[model samples]
Target: MTSQDLLLRILNKLFLGLAAAGIFFGVMGRSRAAERPNIVLILADDLGYGDVSCYGATKVQTPNIDKVAESGLRFLDAHSSSATCTPSRYALLTGEYPWRKKGTGILPGDANLIIKPGSTTLPEMLRKGGYKTGAVGKWHLGLGDGEIDWNTEIKPGPLEIGFDYSFIMPATADRVPCVFVENHRVVDLDAKDPIQVSFKEKVGSDPTGQEHPELLKMRPSHGHDMTIVNGISRIGYMSGGKSARWVDEELAQTLTKQAVGFIEKNKDGPFFLYFATHDIHVPRVPNARFAGKSGMGPRGDVILQFDWTVGEIVKTLRQLKLEDNTILIVTSDNGPVVDDGYQDQAREKLNGHRPAGPLRGGKYSAFEGGTRVPFILSWPGHVKSGVSDALICQIDFLASFAQLTGCRLNQADGPDSLNILPAFVGDSKMGRDYVVEHAFVLALRKGNQKFIEPGKGPKFSKPTATETGIDPDGLFYDLTDDIGETNNLSIQVSEKAKQYQAELEKLRKEGRSRP
Candidate 1:
């Protein structure tokens, strides 16, 4: 047969396979199962800029994530839209800044579903383009509509947002009702003993960190004190659901195994997996083998576990021979915090470890560290590997992927997304014109000049211990000379401040910031 005939035969085989798979597994939530590229967005919870070795972390090695970087693009000036978890995840999935939603600073444990049903999402977009999408692990973004019923199927969640399958912890591991929700129902929930949860009153006589400080391996510094699970105190109250609770130490491997199985089953066609790993997040429970591996305590051990998970995913990709076709984007939700809360010796044994690397501020700071994170795009024979300070943000992913897959996200859909396929593939140097960041206030950037809007109320209520948002009172700084914001150009360069303030307003008014 001629080369053209062979090409046609290959295409016909792939088309037939995808159609059959979609018909067989439509109930699993995969609406489309062809044409789209397999997208695996691996997000690390509360992971710092310096956590991965590729980002200059010296304490522990991340050979797997580093491999992705070595093969593709590693972004040095990339950032999460919000400093905190829930809002950041919201922005990531929705392609819109989190501040727009009312009371969207940082959601509490029992809050209703943040992304309402029928919301347009990255996975939803991919599904339309013919892809099997799944989300496994750490879904801090809330679930259910109005009142959630843990015993029954939760609505307006990952399924409503376009994932074919979902196996997730409802909130942070350090939060209440510690149980895994698979797809719609709570995994292994008992009918005989119902589970009850609340941020208000105690559900039962369950041991709490407040009542039993001696039970804690990692003591809480603030906020994270309520129900006790696996000898660790968390945020909300819970009673019963003993069979459904997950083992803390085994969190990483459990998610990894599930992810691998999903990939193996869907290897024949394009798939989208929003794989959120519960590593180094909270409770800091690293399995026996990885415990104390970094000599920095469980926090460090969890870092190792994160690295192993990355390696396993990469190995699985190689095994399936999908490295070249698959587009792998690895990044963290926010910067690092040595002692956000919890005593994992993160500070005591942090030694010279730089969790935020060279950036100042972390997690909840408007500073460089808060917004900037380690961003990588890997596709083995498709992208050239190199560092770029092109000022990319999580909000940009929606439009970027849409452009890559030959799809369009109408203005209403990806209001914050920008097409930068050339940048992702290392063919273009020109990138985003301006980027808006944070949950509290707006910070606009044009080239090296960055200006932050003063106070528009604020997220944390009280002034955070850290510079959680862009300094209010209209601060303008020339990051080119002073990247740390040490010398306030706000007073000195009032004109530049005015310039970016205008840009900030235009961003909000237009709903999408202009490049």
Candidate 2:
């Protein structure tokens, strides 16, 4: 044969080999993508570490949440990044400490979107890894660019951030403009009755709790006394959009339906569902079926309702035959609060039930109970069914999931999120070397030792009747010995306290803590 003919033959063989290899790798890539589990993160609002039956609450029966623990790994030392809803959620999605950003504190119903439009978010990252993302239920993270017209499209919200679809309450249950926002516009809003919300001043001629106390079915205990919607007074005044307003008692069922719909729609492949439940929050109004079930009044009844919500989700997954290929994470945005705003009988009818369990303080406090929440991960055959004391936080989900989905994250993305996938799936006992807990003040936890930075504030919040866990001088505790944080050991362990204080300050100032 001629030299040219031999060269042509060799080139043809090389091209064929390269094409075959490409096809093989392409098939392998598709297989790996299909293998990625559907992630459903159920974040309960104000659900304390001890609220569920599995977490030691005998008063409240949480069979569904317990089922998750029984089926997979339960995390004993799991924490949210912040003690409050808005900030905690921000951290969970952005992978940056909420304290790192300004305006991340609890916001009014009409507050502008805190998360930037083009930022790299958990849902966005998952989308990059070939997953459909949806967010349902309470979105206290705020919506719109600045001022939002309830009758029009609300831009720069969950959709702009990462989620492909979003059905969320613009804020909390007790907040005004109490309507579900699906994607951009207010759900079921009537154009004729345009919605107007004002946090600064009373908007419209709606009967407010302060003005029409006689008309209210539920009175406010403190500051949640603004617009009256569905006979319940709320914070911030909202006018019109009567058709779009949500019923307090039907909230659980409404949100659950949406969540289930999302799951069913995405059952064919990998999906990320951030189901943030508004249950057990303020203005506890459970459905008639769950109303008197707990015997602990509205608060207890709502807890049962939350469990039902969980059960519904699990049942839906099972029905779709997606349970085995799904990663279900049940946790809370923060700890519990007995009386946040509305005069629900949560505090009056305690009935010997401890919301914070053995942990000290709760909700907005700088204590263990404030950030420490019941975290359960269920992935059928993937994650071993056992108790894991791995020191994990919601903030790490972004990095861990990124690692799991084979998505490469830039240095700027998930700045504070450490890839703790090994510990997440129960492969390792140890997770983060340290985790920063943010509340009214910041606290650093390295090993079992926790150090609360010095801050000036009321020791206790009168409205909520919760210990603020604040001090002018820094406080330290070895949680392994004192999980309640009753005994402050800063004076006894001055050097360790100093070291932790320095570390905490460094972490705060350095801007990122992923390293």
Candidate 3:
């Protein structure tokens, strides 16, 4: 054989060998992508930063939550998008600042669906990325249009947004039409006793807390004096659907059942579950099993109940052998509120327990307690056990999860969500340079300095009895020194305040925070 012929044969053989290796690696890469972990986002309602034992609450024991922190990365400076419920949930799912959208505040039970259909939602993005998405628990994000027929199918809710399956409380536990919504229909509705709900006027002859104090099991402290369901006064008026009315004490177990069912059904592969717990919220009635378990009160007992729910979910994951490949996130919608509207003895039975820890304000406030919450990210074997002080917002989940699942989002989707996947997975220390905190007014946190924009509002909210964190002349604070936000530094650090304000305004006008 000629030398030239032998060299050509050698080259041809080498080329074939490389082609075979390329095919092998390509298949392996696809297999790894297919094994992308399941995501479980456990959102607690009205839970404070210090509510969890892991986050430093001495009054209540949260062993299940603490286990999650120990198993993965616990974030110190994480925040929900808003200080209130509806807006915070809106930002969490849509990845847009709630302030950008008007009418995103705490809504009435009969309010219209705030999230428009066909929008790019977190669940929708995940569903499109080959994952089954389910949302169970409190869905205060209003369902249907302004006028919804409770007897009929409720449209444009979790299902319309993106969830493949959903079992949720239509509104809050302290609201009217106190019923669970499975898919688009009220659970166990009766034709003879049809459900009728109204926020504007009294629709039914149901005894209200104001008219009939004799009928109430737990009296309202303020505005939740409209309708009585399960012997508890709610915020709106509702008639009929007695069978569908949810028992307050059974709420925890009911929601837990649905959550566990979702996980079980989808245990074969990647699934995204948004388990929004109503525990520790208004009308704090824990199940009989957990009742009076906490020495604190119903509030503390519900925290224990919430912890049980977490434990149950983790247990299910472990039982199914899905723990290692699951990304579990435990956080609150906002901070804690002892007495929101109901007289649940959360304040009187405080017993020196600090719900917000060392933070100043709670719930409807611009203080650290309002938005700052315990954020834990656990991905067994993938994310290491540690703590991250990096600034993160629940709104970042959409973009971060998108990046994790190899999904590309344009500017229209998750405009404010940054892909802090590195920080999320304990691979990086640096997170966002600054994060926006929303209450009645807007505040910007750049490094340790936080600047609150001047706004005209009540200095203190009478309902929650919380310092609204609002000032007519604006406010500023160095969080590194004053985490409680005791003294205002707007005058002392005038230039720094102005600089943050200017940057905040610029971000507002830009229409998008992430590139």
Highest lDDT against the true fold, candidate: 2
lDDT per residue for candidate 2 within 176-270, as digits (tens), equals 88999999889998889999989899878998888889999889989877889999989898899999899988999999999999999999978
Residue 240 error, candidate 2, Å: 0.8
lDDT of 3 by residue, 1-515 (tens): 99999999998787556534443223333233456799999999999998998988887899999999999999999999999999999999999998888889888888889998888999999899999999999998999985999899899899999999999998899988799999989999988999888888998798898899899988888888888888888888999999998899899999999999999999996899999999879889988899899988899999999999999999999999999999999999999999887777888888888999889888999988899998999999877899999988899889877767876687788889887766777767778888999999899988788988998989889876898889988899998979889889899989988888898899899988988
Q: For model 3, how many clashes?
A: 0
Clashes of each: 5, 0, 0
For candidate 3, the lDDT comes to: 0.88
For candidate 1, write residues 99-146 as lDDT tens digits.
Answer: 777756666666777786776898888888788989999887888777
List candidate 3 segments past 4 Å from native: 1-34
Error of 3 at 366 (Å): 0.5
Better of 2 and 3 by lDDT: 2
Evaluated against the true structure, the overall lDDT of model 1 is 0.78
Cα lDDT, model 3, residue 3? 100
Clashes of 2: 0
The lDDT of model 2 is 0.90
